[model samples]
Target: METVDLVVPVKSLTAAKSRLRGAADHGVGDPKAHARLALALVLDTVTAALAARRVRRLLVITSDPTVSLEVAAVGVPVAPDTPGGGLNPALERGAHLLRQNDPCAAVGALQADLPALRPAELDAAIERAAAIFAAGPAPRAYCADAAGEGTTLLLCAPGSALQPCFGTDSAAHHERSGAYPLQGDWPGLRRDVDTGEDLRRAADLGVGPRTREVLAPCPHP
Candidate 1:
């Protein structure tokens, strides 16, 4: 079982989760409150990733110094989004750094808003990805988001190009780019909080302590 280097990209707190603002009247109307929720989500995601036994290294790429400080509290190294392109570019930069440090290490990009992510679920997904990598021919693979339309996780074997296409309909895009879709019953791995509805679903599935603490004050409609 080869260790995986996981790259997580987070936007500035003020710019995070804009689409989730008024979703289902979740009471995250205040900008400050929204930033707090966003940070909490990232904290939980990083916490789960750190707990995953298969993840040898976890790197967070972001331009926000505030986010860097927060992630550092959890012992995860933060890298500046020097590429400054977007989500994909940030991921590429992190992957590049990991490869430079250890060219033979497998690298993968994971979404940063998965408050409901479980360590066991992430380990399972990585195990499946490792199997695919070992099978040969296919060098990359992705796990669909909860909606089954977007990509929540994307991986490339060591020395392989990590072509991350994470955006609208990203699942289709990654598949088109030769990344196999992993099939499994990994509910936590699939759940990436975006809209208000998605947040509610994650709440139902049980979120991490950080997310639960932040959402406790805000009443959902």
Candidate 2:
């Protein structure tokens, strides 16, 4: 199976994870704490994605200086979110750049909030997608979020355009756009944290160390 170059888009901390604001152990109205949680989620997600054997390179798209710095420290390239529109546009920019660098490599867009991501699960999903691609003319494939409504991962084979439609009901949107749906038993790959409850579910799945650090209680003054 051909390896993939994954593009992860992260919103600036100031505007990221709004729904998580009042979540227990996730800041609860504290802006600074909220940003830390947001950053932790992205870092964990990136770390796991990079560890996947099927992943050749990972690029993080964001305009936040702190995010750029943190991700760069891990040896992942950072690109500015030039479009400044929304998720899809940022993903498109990342995908375009990756394709420009190596047109033969598959390009994938992954959500930045999957703090519990497991590299093996991601590799299995990508392998499944590769099998489907080899069998037919399908150019794209997507893995649904845990709720089966949103899309957590969208992939396009070499020379295929990654026309992502990631938003509400994005799983269905990607299907309507002709992307095949991958049926992989990957709980960690699907669990993306959005609300307090989502965080709880991810915790149940055993989040990465970075996320665990953020969720750990602060020391008494």
Candidate 3:
């Protein structure tokens, strides 16, 4: 099987994972607690991506400089989005990096919020996509979100002209853009943690050690 490259996109810690933004809106607790939770999710997601065997190398795409704490022990490389734009631009930069290093490597565009993802499950889906690519012309592959409303995982040819679809209704948007959906057992791939509902779903699936450690015993209202 061909090795793959995974790119994880993370927004600023100060503003990431906003659904839990005001977990302590009033005097419930310290405001920094929310930021702490956001950072934990990012770290766990990174750890899972690094754990995948097919992912020879991992690249973290972000504008935030605080990634050092999360990735320091993972040994993965970090590349700041020089374009310094939004999500798409950061992912585009990551795509460019992958194409330059491993021209034929399939790039996995990952959202940095899936704390319940497991390595083996992700590798299975990746191997499946590689099989599909090797069988014929390269096509984009998408992994649906837990709610089944959005997209959580995007795999495509490195440097493919069609960028990843990551916004609202992203599953359909990516499908419309010629990205095929790949089925896998990874709860993480289907969990985007965008709202209170997503968090509850992740808990039901049993989140990673890091996330289970950071978040409350269960997703709170």
Candidate 4:
């Protein structure tokens, strides 16, 4: 079992998930409320990633001190978003750090908003990715989001370029760059909460404790 280093990028809670605010007919309109929800989503994501068997090390890249403190409490390493070039740069920085630490390790980038992500599903995805690299022609692979238009996960084999093209129809961009698309029934892995509707869908799929706790008082609209 080749352990895959998973890099999760989280923006400052205050600035994150802006789209989800007021996205629902009864969505949380308060900025503070949105920040709380965003933090819960990230916490749940980190928790699940920590439990995945195929994950060798889970690193969170963020520029926020509060996020650093929160994730550090969970025993996951926190890296500063040094490049500060946005999502793709943050991921690349994390990957570069991981590779520097362990040159032979496979690396992957995952979104930090998957509140419903289950450990088993992540394990299965990593196993399939490993098999792909082993049977190889392509050096990169990605898992599509539930909408099938965005990419939720992207991976690169050891020694391969972590050319992450994540943002605005990233699924197509990744595929166009020659990263193979990993298809399967990974609903939990695909369900990234963005809109109020997305949060509701993840709730239907049963989100993790943190997300459930945050959303308990504020029901889906």
Candidate 5:
């Protein structure tokens, strides 16, 4: 079995998904505490990736100095963004870094906020992607977000040409563009912390030790 390298794209803490502005309920926290909480969760993402047996290496892509230092503290390599402001370009930079280092390695793109994602689930997804790549000649393929709109996990064929389109409605768009759908692995991987509602949904699934520390009880059914 070929080893997989997982790269997580972490948005800057000060400029993350702030459109859904709201207060955090993590008990003792500041008004901007959610941002810090989000960072904490992202750190855990690397931990989960490192725990997966199928992964040969785990890297985090970000521009935030604090995040970069913090992630490195846990022994995960990080590639800081040089010229990307948004998610798509940020991921592109990560891809560039990976290609520069290991041009032939199979790469997986996972969001940095899925604190509930387990190591087993990640192994399964990577295994499935490796199987698909070996099975056919599909040049471009990836998995969509939880609601199936956002792009949570994307896998590239080893040494094959690939493109990323992980914006809103990414699920349908990826399908229309011929990417296969992955199901029944880890629901937490798809559930990104974008809004209050999203937080509630993640809380319902019961997250891991990393997420449990930063998040307060979410208010939703």
Candidate 6:
């Protein structure tokens, strides 16, 4: 089976998940609680990605001190988002680093907000992506978020650049850049949390243990 390396970029806790901060009663007015939630999201995302059979290696690109410490503790490699420009730069740096070590392996950029990510869904997407790569022409592909406006995963075949354009309408941006759109029923992988509604949806789909634990005591928003 062809496996791939994945780069997951995480923002500092203080700057992460602004839209979700007050969306849940878990941490509506508490910075500490909000940070915990943000950290839990990253941990869950990392855990799920690592569990995917097609994932050969996963690197976390982050400058957040707490995130760096936590992810390292779990045995996932950590690299500083040295460029510090934005999401794309951070992803590019991590992809470049991974390519340096394993030039033949495909590299991918994944979002850090997918607390409900499923290992099988990710494996299925990568399996499909491998087929696309073998077909040739476009060496990049992306999985759109649930709304189909944003991107949750961007993949680049060996020798292709991971030029991530993550922001508003990122799914359209990726497609315009010649990345084939991945089609599947990967609800857990596509349902990245941003709002209270998004969280509710993730809960319905079943979140990872860390996220579930954090929300266990909080009232449903």
Give the per-residue lDDT of model 1 (tens digit) for 23-139.
423653777777878888899999999999999999999988889999998899999986458888889889989888688889999999998999998889888988988898588
Clashes counted in candidate 1 amount to: 0
Model 3 lDDT per residue over 1-221, tens place: 47678788877777777677654233254557677767778888888878888787778876667765467666867887664477777787787787786677777788888888888877888888777766754567888886676877788854455377778888888888888778777776678787766766777887777767766543553
* Model 3 CA deviation exceeding 4 Å by range: 22-29, 82-84, 158-162, 216-221
The Cα RMSD in angstroms, rounded to one decimal, for candidate 3 relative to the true structure is 2.5
| lDDT for position 107 in model 5 | 72
lDDT score of model 1? 0.87
TM-score to true structure, per model: 0.95, 0.95, 0.88, 0.95, 0.87, 0.96
**Model 5, range 61-169, lDDT digits (tens) per residue?**
8888888898899898888776546767767667767778789877767888787777888888777777777888464567677776777777777786446677778
Per-model CA lDDT versus the true structure: 0.87, 0.89, 0.74, 0.88, 0.72, 0.89
lDDT of 6: 0.89
Worst lDDT run of 10 residues, candidate 4, spans: 22-31
Clashes of each: 0, 0, 1, 0, 0, 0
Model 6 misplaced regions, further than 4 Å: 24-27
- How close to the true structure is residue 89 of candidate 5, measured as C-alpha lDDT? 72
Off by over 4 Å in 2: 24-27, 218-221
Clashing pairs for model 4 are: none
- Candidate 6 lDDT, 73-103, residue by residue in tens: 9889999876458888888889988988678
Query: What is candidate 4's lDDT per residue for 76-111, written digit by digit as tens?
Result: 899888645888988988998888978878999999
lDDT of 2 by residue, 138-217 (tens): 88999999899999999998889899999889999999999999997999999999988888889888989988887878
